[model samples]
Each structure stands twice: as structure tokens, then as C-alpha cells.
Target: MIALLSALLQGCALPSLEGRSESHALKRAETADTALGRALMPQAQARPGLSGILPLADARDAFAARVLLVRAAERTLDVQYYIWREDITGNLLLDALSEAAERGVRVRLLLDDNGVSMDAKLLALDRHPAIEVRLFNPFSVRRPKALGYLTHFSRANRRMHNKALIADGQAAIMGGRNVGDEYFGATDGVLFADLDVLATGAVLPELSADFDRYWASASAYPIDRIVAPEGTAPAPVPHAEDDPRAARYLQALRESRFVADLLAGGHLPQWARVDMVSDDPRKGLGLAEKEDLLTHQLQQVLARPPVASLDLVSPYFVPTAAGVDVFSRLAARGVRVRILTNALEATDVSAVHSGYARYRKDLLRAGVELHEMRRGAQPQGGGAGVFGSSGSSLHAKTFAIDGQRVFVGSMNFDPRSAHLNTELGFIIDSPVLAQAVTQAFDRDIPASAYEVKLDEGGGLVWTERRDGQTLRHKREPGSTLVRSVWIGLLSVLPIEWLL
Candidate 1:
């Protein structure tokens, strides 16, 4: 019964691990040394500015940054994104890129093949002479059924989820924001309240190198390959050498919401700055090493016993027993350690919530402040609401420590993110950025989350706030009748990797 229930819980799983063929191996081999290697090497330095971490709170800010970089480009513009839609946000940026390309700026655009849906305008932009667009891990699910199935197996395992942009071989944007509305707070229903750093100075070279490695990678397919069937006209290569108006791309970007945020917030010249230069990108570093780095950072932060507080605001919280122990040690030291994650009813991925629910009692017993975001957590600061509002979910992944250090990025506190997915983040030393993000976390705590509390009768209950009303509900969903049914029915599935 337990096996059957586990299997049922793994329903409709996406393929997470797939064996690689020689062809795939050869492709990776081709780009590994050439592309990944170049991104790690140092390059000529650019003149310094007020180089520090600039917080991007809206889509307009992100868009504006891209435009500024593209306009400022003299030699090259290397961009790598997980998804670049042809939506309003995507088109505006593409227009900017096209303009830059016409001005003789070498623009190499690389994207993950997973999320890009076919659009005529995007295909046409890719056909531009100056712009060289490539898709990482190319697959053709948009085609006929035959092609989709064949391509399906090809994309079953690896996924390119990195998002970065570099311009003039000088400056770069690296963080969680992808080239999409939701990521940038421009989407209608679900704007992701995300974080990214507009890093200048030494970090630019490292960022550029990262872009280059992916650009020359074996998985990269030229934009021309992002085509349609015989009936569809080949996307026109607009703005050839004869077209001299690509210069306007910069101006268009300047007028966008992206730039307005910078100009309005003074994020450019204002804000404390940090100049970081990494001689190597993590490609040379193994996954286990990255985990160790995170462990080290956490240990460093928790080294001194604190009487006050610890708060975690990760959207996905799936800590292993070892991770739980770390928090327990902190609690033992009298630190008020608290954690926030999505509730099962409000979670977008139920399997992840299932994995997390397994640890609720352990976490609570260790005196960790555990919170689960309730549905309909309203969007703050023009950020989008999670879908199913009235039952919206939590999507932000962040962690704040000692009201001082903060880490933000695409990384989810999950086994997949910690081990499988390649994640990147910054250790913001700025108290200001830390406070801003922490405050954001606190604001939502009241209306959108439930505090995990133990009753005097040794029962677990979740006290939540909604619609200006506080309500206490059973944390274990009261009856385990459904759980028992599920355990008996869902345990025999072969979907662990997808989860």
C-alpha cells in the first residue's frame, strides 16, 4: 500500500534524468573547452563606476538595464537567457538588440530551448545579420507529433536554466530575472518579486566569460535553426548593412520601464557598492564543491552564537536531515530560527510539498519557526500575485540572516536545486538590501502565512491569517484518510527523478 501511494503521488512527472548518447557527448565536448573555458579567462578591464549591488524590483528596471547595456556596446554583446519570449517585454529587448546589431555591435544571444515558444517576430529577429542567436539543448516539440516525440527524449535529462547578459565585454547582469514579464514584475497575473544585481567592474569579465562558454557550447543551435515547416515563410533578416537605423535601439531602451526604474530609484549612482572579480566560473568546480561553499557560508554566519534571530524565506524548503541538524544546532544556541515555505494547498508543485511535509514535525520539534504561505498572498510593490489567488502560491526564493547577510536567486532550497540544477546567487553584504528583502519577507508573513504551532495537547496546528481574519487549522489536514488512501495508491511510481 505504501509503495502504491508513493507511485500515485509521482503522477505526470517530467523526465529529470536521461542517459547521454555519443552524439550528445561529442556536442558537449566540442563546447566544453572552447566556450566554457573562455568565460573563465580574464579580459581587459573597463573604467570603474559606482560598482555595487543594485536592487531590481520591477520589470521595467530589468528591461531598462538591458537596453542601456546594448546601447553602450562598442565591441560585443553576449546574452544568455533561460527564456526570451516574443511577448511585449521580449520584443522590446529584441528590437534593442536588432538596432545594436545594425550598428555593427556583435550580439550573440543564447537561450535555453525548454521555454521559448515559436513566434514569427522572434524568428524574424533571429534572422537578423548582426544578431547570432543560439538555443541550448535544441528540441522540436512545437513541430508535428513525430518530431515532438523524437525531440522529447533528447531533452529528458539536462536543462539550461542560467540567465545572464553582458554588453561591450564590460558590464553584466546576473541574478534570478529571466527575459520574461513574470520574472520582472511585468506579467499580468503573476509577477515574480525577484532579485538581480547589476554588477559592474571585475564581475563583468566573469559574467561575459560565462555567457561565452554557453554560446560556443555543443547544445547551442543557430537562430536560423529556430524555424518552421515548409508552409511557413523563412523569417526575414531585417536590418542588414543597408539599414542604418539600428542605432535607435539604445534610445528605445532608454525610454523603457527598465531604465525608468534605475533613473527613478537612483540604483545606478546610489546604493553601496562591492567590486568582485572571479578568476574562474564554477564550471571547473564540481557540484559537491558548490554545496560545500554554501555549507561554509552558512557555518560562517552561524559560527557566533546569537541570542536574537534567524529567518529563512525560501519558496521551496526541502532540507535533508543534515540541513535540519544545522538549524537545530542554531536553535540550541538560543537563536530564534524561523523558516517559510509554501503550504501544500498553496504549492504549485505538490510533490515538492510532499517531500517537505515529511520534515514538518522534525523542524517544529527543533524549535524552528516554520511558516507556510497561504493562498492569495497579495502582491506587494507592483509584483505579480501567484496563480490560483484566492489561492495564490509563493514563488520567491530568498534567505535572510542576522538582519545582515541575504542570499537571493533562482535557487530553491530543494534537493534538485541544491544538487541537480546549476544555481547562482550573491552574498549581499549590504544591510540595506538585506533589510529591504527581509522587510518584504516580514510584510507577507502576516496575511499570507501560517505559523506552525504546537498545542498543549501535543497536537500540530497551523494558525493562518486571511482577509483580515486569523484562523487556526489542523496542520496535518486533520484526518489522514486521504493520506492513507494516497500512501496505498501513490507509492509504486517510478517518478522520483522528475520530482
Candidate 2:
């Protein structure tokens, strides 16, 4: 396995390290974080900015703000991702990062080493002096080709499944969206199950602290350390400057008719009140090093007496036996618990559903409301064609309790997010925000999902609420067969934690 990892990483060479002039961007970045500092801190305000649950059905508004933040950055910019394709969206982001670095901004980019196979433009970014990139838990191969045949047990089961961008130590965007078109709903004939949170306040400091911790961790390797002296090693890419259309992928994206429709959709609803919390400092807020804050907090909340209603939306739901016990206890307390997760066929990760399938009966016995997003919904734009026909999946992760509190972040409802990978999100203690999120859930639940009900034969059947249609299979006509085959094959792979 070590041999395989080494080959993959070596073939997907990182940028060579050359000393670059240091700029004063760090100081400016510090000040920016401080300017937005007070609001993120819990002691300063009950909520920051306008905190409301919003339905982000498109990419324009959020993407525009993201670009602006990257452009406005004056000092340090830290970005981490599980995937960063060399597509239009990826190029746009890299351009912004390059612009920031050219202005003397200290930029650090972290990406999962496993995804190097899909990266075609990673080496080019290394030429910039102000930018430093690292791969998390990189494989050990010194050569390329045939590395896939080797599979080591170590790190082979671990992954850095986090999505975060910290600029000037104050503002951050954290959630499910990665550096991919599908993630932002900008891909052709595809829409993803994803969510993200943008914040400018005290929470920025906490996120920065985590970024610094991870940046300095043993798992990270500076780009300079990975690349050999210029003339010493074989070139990974024959020509860097010769790649004339490196950023042309975005143009293809523009050609997609659905892309325009999604752009026309309105922006995410801004919250009038937002509350931010980091897991207690003693535990590093349950980031990478410990139990995930999302899972730990969810466990704690479940321990309490039941509330009248609890609504949950998670794309990946893999409940363990103990977890089911906790939820069952809540039901015993009279709390009307309801949940929405990707159905078996609608899921992008079938192994997660496999784990979840083991506990479904237990959850149903405990009286939890369960629903799964359907294959189609009114496209973000007015009408739908291939975009609607694609068997889209659920990607949002959220929880609402008694319409009083809401949690949003990059964390998923799986063992990786709960006990392995580093994750982050916001916990708002506002009835108004909770109500908005809950209302959005109510509307979303009815149209795009099906409620799971127990039939007379003691089996589960899906019921579409819109037209009262009932179906057993999750696959719908025109679904992406490639995705189905991919998920099926990946689900059988033993190393789910690594994925």
C-alpha cells in the first residue's frame, strides 16, 4: 500500500519549493480578522449579522461573494479542500489566489493527497512565490505508474475531508462545497447535495487557529520539500506555459444552459441573527484531533429530554447501534424526531448507506421521521431538462430542535466526521433562524423527497408526496448510470474511511 501511495503522489508531483520574497500581507490579514472579530465571539453578541436559514439553489451570489473575499484579501489566505479540479471554477479560484499572492498575500493551500489523480494543474500554482501548497497524508511512492495496485493500511483509511477558506484571519466559508462544478451546481447535467456557511466574526479566529494547527501538523509537507531540484527529476508535465487553455474549462461551463438558469436564481437568504460556537477550547472544538464537534454536540443534545419536534437533514446518514439507542431514548421521551437522508439509490456514497441500513430498523422502531430526496425537482432555474433528469442527491447537513437552535457546517453524519476527520460548522441559538430553516425544510421535504413509511408487510416503501406516487427502487429514468456504477463499485471497496 505504501508503494501505491508513493507512486500516486510522485506521479502527481507538487510544486518545487523556491524561496520567495515575503510581503506585509500577513499584518493586513491580521487586522481584517480583528475587524470582524467581536461578532464571532459568543461574549460579544447573541448573533452576528443576519442569521437565517437560507436555500442556496444557485451559484452566482455565493460564488460572487467568494470571489470578492478572495480578491479583497490583503494578507494571509488559507484554503483547504478535498477536491480541486482544473475546471473553470477551480481556475477562477486559483486566479484569485494568484492575484492575492501577487499583492504580497501569504497564501497556503491544503488538499487531500488522494485526489492528486484528478488534478491536472496543481504543479503550475507552485511557480508563484507567495503561494505554498501541501498535500495531507501524502502517499510515499517515489516513482509513478502502477501505484494503484499497491494499497497500504495506514492513511489508506484516513482522509482530510474538510472544506474551509480563511482570509485575513477573520472571514471564512465552511461547508460541503468543494472545488468542483457539481458542488456549486455549475456542472453540466448535474447538481450536488451540498451546503456551505459564510461567516465574518469571532468564529474566524477559531477557524484560523485550527488552520494554523493543521498547517503545522506532522501530516503536512511544504511544496518545496516534495519537488526535486529543477534539472534533477523528470518533468511531471511536459509544458506549463504551453498549456494555452489551462483555464478554458470554465468556458464549457458557461455553455451549459442550466448554468445560466442557476445564475438567475436569487442569492442565499441572509440571517438577521447568527450565533457562532467553537467546541470548548479544551478539546480544540472537536476538530481533526478529537471527536467531531458536530457529532459530539449531537450526542449531547440527544442525551437531553425530548422536545416536541426535531428535524434533521443529512446527505450521508450512517447511524451506529449506540447512536440508534440514543435516538430511541429521545423518542421514549416523547420527542417527535424526524430525519431526511439520501435514499439508497439517491446516495453518492453507497457504503455510508450500507452502514446506515444496519440501523434503519432500529431508528424506525424508535419512531424517527425519515425521508430521502428524490431524483428530480424544479431545477434552480424556471424549467428543467437534463438538469432535472439527472438523479441528483442530497448534500445538505443540518439539524433543528424545537425551532430554537440550528447547526450548519461541513460536517457529515458519518463516522469519519464524527470521530476521524476535522470538521466545522455554526450553532445558532435563535428561534427565528430555526423557524426559517425548519420552514425551508418543510417546503423542501414535500416537493423533492419521499417519506419512508412502514407497510403492512413490515418493510419500508417510499411515497412521493407531490402526486402520491409510490415506488420501491430509488433509480429514476434518465439517472446517471455512470454515477450508479461508480457508487456501486466504490461501496464494495473496503477503504471507505479513506474516501
Candidate 3:
């Protein structure tokens, strides 16, 4: 039995990338005559060097934009994400991609192996001549995937956290969202308050080039190479017309004017100088140079410190000792650094909250303001707005600096984003968008989040304003004592780097 087990494990070894075909994204000229290109070119040409940016803060609109982009693709569709759940919206998007392929649109789907598990469905999708599926940093052992971690911890630990969708090298959507029900507000469970932008013009090519880099990287293995051949792909999941959630999303699709306005040339975006920043694909193998990392690039781009205000919204805000010092110095210099992150009961990952919790007092003492999003904090008007819907947890990773610039993307203000996973985002020189974030901090944030402050005794206190009354909690609100104790225990551990 032991010998057989050893042989089975040995057989699970990964295949080599020798002779893998190299493919590049279609050039701008090749897609200039495409439908999406035709609709967006005039505005793009007018701007010359600026990219048209339409922030998809509404969850429904964010999902609609991707679907509409896929439906409009003429030449090719390049899609990449860390997670693609097999739920309602995920299946719908998969079906849409397959439909696009049926119409002769070449579909290249790259997903992180750790975030997906539908081997049979993915292998089936790979069978389509028009569609190709690849997994990033895939596990060798199919069953009991933990075995791969034991065998190749170094490689398996690093992930491709970038999310993007490019159509015919003309238009793209990039941001903090993955393809899942939670991301799109299609679930009654924990909905993620995420952000994505529909971008056109100068940034499309750069985003496409970045997708190509990741798709062709050594870590990306074709699905056939990872999973064995399965029978014909299962029939695509049909739209659940009967499910109330599905009906609601369908209504949202009909209500969303984002794509329609773009196609009709009626929607004008804030044309600005948008710079794309991404971690080198080599970072997945721990081979990227320090200068090539996204952190260094971000610092170089936003070189000057914030002169006025810094409003940051990160779901997992683990500002290690270094980050605390930076924020402390910023506050000392009179920068109004206000951060909004998930509270303990609201966070999807409790471990991450521990990492952020340990530094709460230090940050408050430095004059930096802290706001913890309350669990189930629905957006005003009961819609799935940028801050999220009912049963929502903050998943957006964004920040506005000095009220003159803003950043929207997948990079989080955490150690893992700094040194572990590859990340992507864009920095835009748009006061309009930047102030929108700051305005939210001034208005909606105070209503939905708890204010963390240092009391007279130097201990932390959480103040909640609800239904015209101000409430105070000595302990973390909505979080149980045992859970808090567990988090405290985790805070003392040496796992901040992993958070």
C-alpha cells in the first residue's frame, strides 16, 4: 500500500513548459476596426494620450459591464482572475464567454489554480477550439491538493492576484473583483463591496500587454497539462429565471445604462492620464527585482507625500510596523489619513483582522483616523452601491491621495500584496474621482462604520452612530469575546507576513 501511494504521488508531478506555444495579444491596428474599437476610438482620438475611465462602483453595473464587453468583442477576449466560482454569476459569465467563442471570438481564460476547483468543467471548456483555459501555479496532486503544498510550498504559496478582462485589445475592465456571486452582489451571503472600472483608449493596450505577460508566464499551465481529459464539457448552467436573486440581477442588467451609453457614445468618462501599475509576473517565482515590484513602482509614481488628505479603503488592511510608521509620519505632517477597513464581525477572513487589529491603537495615537465597517451595512437606498449591500463586507481596495489623485485596483495595503502575490491597479490624475472617495469618507462612511479612537486612558474605544443615537462599546462591537480572544492570540503570532 505504501509503495502504491508513493508511486501515485510521484505520478502527480507537473509537466514541463518546454515547447509551449507562445501567443501574444492582438495589436491595436488588428482590432481598430472591431465594434468596441469603433465605438470608443473617436473619444479616444480626441483625448490623444488620456484614457477614458468609467468607475463601476455599483455591483450590478460592474457585472453588466463585463457581460456587455464580452458580448461586444469581435476579435478576441482575454480574461484573467484569481477566483471564478461555479455559482450563478460565475456560470453566467462562463456561458457568455462560451457564447462569444461560438461566434469565433478567441477566448483565453487564465485563472489562479488555488482559487478554483472545477477541474471537470474547466477541462471541458478547454476542449472548445475557440476557448483556451490555463491555470496559474497549479497544484500537482489533483485530489488532496494539500499534498502539493507540502511538496512545493514555496511555489504554491505565491499567487497571481491580478484581475482583468480585455476585449479585442480595445477595451478593458480592471479592479479588485473576481468572478463570483459575492463580488457581484448576487448572493444573500457575504457580498463584497468591490470596485472595477471600464477603461478605453490608451490604457487598453497596456492592460492587454499585462494579461499577455501573465498568460505566457512560466506559472501558467494549460488546463490539459494539469487536469486529465474529461468527457465532453457539461451543459452550461442555464439562467435561473425562477430564482428571485437571478430575477433581481436580471432587472439590474436592464436598468444599467453603462454599456448602452458607451456603445451609443452618450457616456463620457473622465479622460485623464491613467498609469497602469502591476507587479512583474516574475514575482510569482520570487525572481522579480525590487525595483520591478509594484510597490516600488507605486512609490515612484506617487512620489510626493500627501499634502492634505489620504483616504484609503482596503478590505484587508494589515499595516505592519513599517506601514504604521508611514501612516504615523503622514499624520504628524498634517495629512488627514483616514482608513476604512472591515471590522472583525464583518471581515471574511478573521485572521486578516488580527493583523490589522494589533496596530489600531498605534494608528489612532498618531492622529490617523480609523473606521471599521459594520457587518451587514447596506448602502443607502438599499441598493448595491460602492460600499456594498446587505450582509456586505468591504472588499474594495482603493485610496485617494491629496484630493487630487486616486487609485483603483487589486493591490491591497497589506504585507501579502507587498511581497507575496502579484498585484495590478491604475493611478489616475483625476480630482473628480479622488474627491468622490473623500466625499464618501465625509458622508456615507461615518454612517456605516465604527469610529476607532484612543480614549483618555490610551486604550481603544469604538463609537457607533446609529438611528440618531451614539453608542459606545468597550470591546469590538458585534464580535464575541471568544473570537476577540482568538484574534488577540493570533496577533501575537509571527504570521503578519502571510496575512
Candidate 4:
């Protein structure tokens, strides 16, 4: 490992995107999105400042919104994400971007390096003249992949956890879901109950500016420069959908009814004011020494230290001592705090669950209502979530404050989001949205979650409703003994900060 690390250090240094920085004022009607951009401007201008906020509760709506936005964009598309897997979902999105590029729509894709493993699809996508791919705080090693991480673990540990898709500088989608099947609810195994917002009013420019800052920042490394044996960006050429892999992706895109719905533009609303919030990308590189986090900014925007209720839904919930204290104080003040997170059976990452389980008892003792999402929790109507399959885990990082505010973003209620990852989200002061999200929270508590309570003996009891039948378990659901052992062993490890 030492030799490999040494070799990586001796390898090519991180490349530069120096001359690539170009600033252009956001021209609304003048841009290529003339068809759609022009039509929305008049109506968008009339609505307060920036409204038209719609919650993408359904995974199909979220994915389709992105695809439609890409298709509708005629001027430019700025897409940024923490994880952009080279999976079925990823390829289909890429194919759509390619078609948009073919039409001369300039597409900028800014992805976190830590979230991506260097591969052929990324290289191929980066080659498009109309498409530009930039990696935030990229790794140096090109040959022995893992060596780069080991050598620069400190720097690589911090990641850009922001996810947004902006088109024509007029519309955007920002939230917890990354570019993958699981996020889209297409994964055959476990599906994440994620949240995203489809907004098309005044918030787009704010998102665009943030995208440019990271794109031109010192950290953004062009993909061509990161991979060694530097290859030329592939020239604009014929569609590669002839390849079997490419065909599969294109086929999914073609058959999706969401494609038609989004193109019609009648699904989402077109009015309301939304405050756009994002952490500077420098936060990921530790250069934001004096900078406040997006979370802090969100707190200020929320303007409520102590509220009547706090409904939080986070997949990876590791409330450290500080978090516990916050919840404990809220509970003391008669504030109802309801939290929903993945159970041992549903979590994709065991370490996160281990870290979170440590605080379950603490929270319950403090009067904070805690619900661990069951592996097969379904809506009361037995309606399947996006995955519409067996396993379902909570991935939506959102919280409703009081009954008038809601926050949905990539910021998980964990140390990684608060301290390490640069995150983004919207703290909309829409009571309508807040109520909807709050209702969802309340529904999940009974139908799709395990209400954790303490028995008279000071032990944990998980009460869950399955198939219209209520059941109680004294231990962790499914694999009780084995899961306990796994979480117990992992909880002892000193890695809470990573979670």
C-alpha cells in the first residue's frame, strides 16, 4: 500500500481547468430555450418573486422532470451531483443529455470525484463537444485507483454532497436523490424514499450561479485531465445507441410516460417564492475556514430555534451528542420531534445504522418520537413506493418545522453533512408544502415505520404494522441476533465522525 501510494504521489499531478472559466450573464428570453423560456418568463414574472414550487414525491416525477428539463433546454444545462453512477439510470440520463447536446444545447455536468469511480462511460460522456464534465476535488491516482484515496483520505473525506439539475437558467431540481436506479426507485432490491423539488420560476439563476462557482473554482478538474494517458474529447459524432448497452438506456427513456407528462408542462405548479440555499463548494476542500454551513444558513432562514413540532426524515441518522441535546431540549419545551430513519434490515450502509442506533435510546428517553423504517413498509393503501418492490428504506433528507416550513435537500442529519460534505437544499416557507410533508411524516410513523419505545424494563421495543396487522418485536426486526451483533460491534468502532 505504501509503495502504491508513493507511486501515485509520483504520478501526474491534479490537472487544471484554468482557461475554462467563462462568465456570462443569465439572459432569459435571448437564450436558445426561446420556445419554453420565453413562455414561462411572463407568467413567472407575475408570481411574487420566485414561486412555482412543486414537491416531487414520486420517483417517476423526479426522474421525468430532469429528463424533460434536459429536453426542453435549448440554451444551456447545468447538472451537478455528488454521485453519478454509470448504471442503467445514469446511462439513460447521459443519452438524453447527448441528444440535447446534438441540438447545440451546451450541457455542463459537475460531479463529485469521490462519488464516481473513473470509468469508460464518464470518459465517453466528457468527450462530447457540447457536454463538459468537471469533477470536484478530484483524486490524483489514475492507475491504482484505491491508492489515491488512502494517500489523500483527509482531503477526499470531504465531499460535495449537492445534487441539482438546472436547465436554460430558468428551472431546476434539487434534493437528496443522486443519479442511480436506487434513487429513481428502479433498483430491484432496496429503494430509497427520496425527495426532490421541481421548480421553474426565479430560483434557477441562483442555482446556475452556484454551479458556475464550482465549475470555475480551483477544485473543479476537467475529466480529460484527471484520467492519465490524456485522451482528446471525442468529436461530436453519430449516436452510439447502436451498442446494446446504449440501446437499453435509450429504450427506457423512449418508453417512459414521464417523458410525455413533463413535456406537456401541466403537472407542476407555476407560482410562489422560494429561498435558494447552497454551501460554497470550498466547504468540501476545507477552504471555507470562516464560512458558515448551508445548514446554519438554513437555520437562520427557518428563524425558529424552538418550535411546536419538528418532523425529520433522514436515511442515515447518527445524532451525535449535540444533536441529542437539541432534540432533548426541544422535547423538554413540549415540542414534538418525530424522526424516521432506516432500520437494520433496510439500511444500505451498516456503519451508518450502527452509529445511529447508539442514540435511539437516548432520543426515546428524551420524549423524542423515533420511528425506524421497516424493510417492507408500504402506504396504507398498500401502494408501493418508487421501487414498488420488497425492500424500502428512507433516503429523503427533509424536515418540517412547526406547520409552516419544510426543508428538503441532500443534507442528512449526520456529522458528514454538517461538518464534511458541502450540501444544498430549499427552506421554503410554504405552509402548503410544509403540511404535505408533515402529513407524509405522520403517515409513515404508523403504516411504514417501527415506533421505537421503551418497555418497563428500559429496553427497546419496536412496534410495526404490516399487512394490516400490528406486530411487536423486542429486538431488531428481521435478523435480530445477527443484526444486534453487527451493530454492536460496529458501534464500538471510532468512526461516528465519518457517518
The Cα local distance difference test for each model comes to 0.57, 0.59, 0.87, 0.77
User: Weakest 10 consecutive residues, lDDT, candidate 4?
Assistant: 382-391
Candidate 4 lDDT, 333-420, residue by residue in tens: 9999988888888888998998998888899999999988887567666553322223377788888888787787899999998888
lDDT of 3 by residue, 179-210 (tens): 98888878778788778888988988889889
Query: What TM-score would each prediction reach against the true structure?
Result: 0.70, 0.74, 0.95, 0.91
Q: What is the lDDT of candidate 2?
A: 0.59
Better of 3 and 4 by lDDT: 3
Query: Using lDDT as the measure, what is the rank order of every candidate, best first?
Result: 3, 4, 2, 1
Candidate 3 structure lDDT: 0.87
Predicted structure 4: clash tally: 2
- In candidate 3, stretches whose alpha carbon ends up further than 4 angstroms from where it belongs are 1-9, 231-248, 255-262, 380-391
RMSD (Å) per prediction = 9.5, 6.9, 2.2, 3.0
Q: Highest TM-score, which number?
A: 3
Off by over 4 Å in 2: 1-29, 32-57, 118-120, 142-151, 227-294, 297-306, 379-391, 467-499
